[model samples]
Target: MKTSMAKQKKSKSLLRREWVKSMVQNRYLYLLMLPAIIYLVMISYRAMYGILLAFKDYNPKLGIMGSEWIGLKHFKNMFTDPYFRHVLLNTILISFGRIIFTFPFAIIIAIAFNELKQRHLKKTLQTIYTFPHFLSWVIVSGVIFNFLDYTGPVNSMVAAFGGERKVFLGDKKLITPILYITDIWKESGWKSIIYLAAITGINSELYEAAELDGAGRWGKIWHVTLPCIRGTILVMLTMRVGQVLNAGFDQIFNMSNTVVQSTIDILDTYVYRITFQQTPDFSYSTAVGLFKSVIGFTMVILVNKLSKKMEGTGILD
Candidate 1:
């Protein structure tokens, strides 16, 4: 007992000393972060109270606290709905497709940009690429419509080739792929910026040393370049997996019509349709959103755990 007590005392002393040292060294930094800490407490933590609606028959008239509880009814309704399956599938398919295609392209663009010796040309190209990221889905929709409508440039070109005018946007078979392709074209360049920053941070001496030892461009990239940026890639991938259920709601909603809604309807649109257009049940929508949040939060924990086991450095640690 005495030995154990002594060890405990020593540990307490060490912790207290470290805490004091940290407080002295970083008190100003902590003070600077105070506003952000308070903001998170007010916004993030306070907003969590809205989740109580998921368990209640929330009405604007009755208000949140006075609402009658009807636990799990909304969830049960969701499970029984036939359209839920389609929405769930669309969400997963679109999110996964983006992850698979977009990530590698970002990495490749970053690597290629790092290879360019002309600074002016490289900056100009990057600026051009980044321009599309600023365009909202509404603007993007207008641009897409102009090219895809019956009498648009595409149809004119097709007519010149002796082909019939095609309604690309309205076609169920084409809409999902077009959504994915257009999304990639719009966002990939901007997304590559972070990866390019990571690539630029890699030590030039490593590449020079490899070249000195007779390594080619491909050889250096395979060995040095990829390994250096793998951590950033892993973190980005884990974040994507955490959000695998959210598949560009604004983009989908703007681009989709009745013709392609079956193929492109996702959880957000489903919730919006149920809450606003059909049932107008605030509680049901809250329940659905809460369920989505739970699933996403759980997925982040599970994926982060697996990533820690595989890669040693997961998202958090």
Candidate 2:
């Protein structure tokens, strides 16, 4: 027993020494990662303590730690609230709508950009397309209001064209589609950068081989380009699936008004309204946020698993 214990102790000490040596060897790499590490620790990990507020009756005077524990009370209320159910349904619908409509635009745009032969023209077009992503939702909303408001250019054009003026923003049926369109317009170009990078990394030999096989541009794209970027697409898709619950809070909040509020009231907006617009219920709001997080986490795990099963690899892997 003594001999075995000594061997174990010596092994542990040797492993520690090796780990220290490896760390010293990669000191520069660690230095490069320091800012991200600090951000995760200070901004993300530190905020995790607030999650406890979901199970507590939070009071400003009492503080997070001092608050009375009311385990599952807020969760029970959330489950029973009809408005919450409606909000959840809306969130799911809008999120799926974006996945269906907005998600593919990035891939398509990336492919189109890759096909452009003129470098200067491609760069100019890419700059024009990606410029919208930098504009905040507040600015975008103002532009939308200017274009879609009553007596705006669109309405004026409709009037001139012998058609009735339309309240585009106020129309519930139009709002969801508008959201998808705006999201695609603003984000698709910037998001395409990833796929473009993936495409750049693809071996040119594959394309040459396809060309030799009498494969044209379309054939090369369908076979070589797409197959090469399939992993990146799957990884991106898995990450997007993880965010299934987040249906653009900033965009929805800025664009939504009383007329279309009910139709676009997602979980984030619902929490915001309950917490700030009406009577503040910190515990309930926290509970809602927690629920959203749990659902998102579950979605990520499930999708990652599905990706692994289908492709023999996953985001987590």
Candidate 3:
């Protein structure tokens, strides 16, 4: 027993000495990594110090540290506010609408792109599709205004056909579908890149065997292609679930009008309104932001667990 104990201690000490020697030898490499570590500390953790404002009755005169703590006050107000249900409903509807409507479109488009035999045509199509994603929401909004406004080309076409000019952006009934379709237009192509990459990673031999076994194009897509890319789908869905509350702030802010506010206003816009439209109550805004973050974190955890249960794997894995 005494001899065994001595050997264990000697082995641990040797390992520790080796680790120390390796680190010292690579000290310059460690030094090279310091800037990124410092940037992360500055950008990610430095702002965490301000999170204390969430629990405080912050006053500009008193400062964040000087303010009185008021636990759950903002949270309670947030949940119980009159517009809470509306904003929550819109946020949820818009998020799930994208999942149901836009997500499948991206998948289909990816599969369609993967089927293209002509490389030049495929590359051109991909470039055309992805170009829209590079455009800023501000610029896209301007283009949308140009295309959909009362005097725009769409309404002109309607007028030519002797049909009534439609309100595309502001009508409550039209907003949900408009939001989803526009999202599909702007992001579906770009989002398909992940699926395309996943498709590429799939073994070509699987497809060759399927072809020999009398599987048709559609059959192969349904049976082989989809199953292979299903993990990527699950991971993307998990991420989308995590972002359920993050309704596109820039798009909503730019495209929403007074008439459509009740239809499209979301949690992010609510935070902005509180901060800028109302009194600049730092505590209140921070509380709202913190609440959003907590919900998103909880959602990611829950969905990741659910994915593990159903698929025997998870986004984290």
Q: Pick the candidate with the highest lDDT.
A: 2
Model 2 lDDT tens row, 1-317: 99999999999999999999999999999999999999999999889889999999999999999999999999999989999999999999999899999999999999999999999999999999999999999999999999888989999999999999989989989999999998998899999999999999999999999999999999999999999999889888888878989999999999999999999999999999999989899889999999999999999899989888878987786
Clashing pairs in 2: none
lDDT of each: 0.88, 0.94, 0.89
Per-residue lDDT over 146-220 for candidate 3, one digit per residue giving the tens place of the 0 to 100 score: 999998999999999999998889789998788788888888999999999999999999999999999999989
Candidate 3, 36: how far from true, in Å? 2.1
Model 1 lDDT per residue over 1-317, tens place: 99999999999999999999999999999999999999999999878988999999887888889999998998898888878877888789989988886768878888889889999999999998889999999998999899888999989999999999989988988887798788878888998999988988999999999999899989899989999998888888888888898898989989989888888889999988988899688888898899889999999998899789768877866
Per-prediction TM-score to the true structure, in the order listed: 0.83, 0.86, 0.88
Clashing pairs in 1: none
Q: Note each model's CA RMSD in angstroms.
A: 4.2, 3.1, 3.1
Which candidate leads in TM-score?
3
**Which sequence of candidate numbers ranks them by TM-score, best first?**
3, 2, 1
What lDDT score is found at residue 214 in candidate 2?
Answer: 99
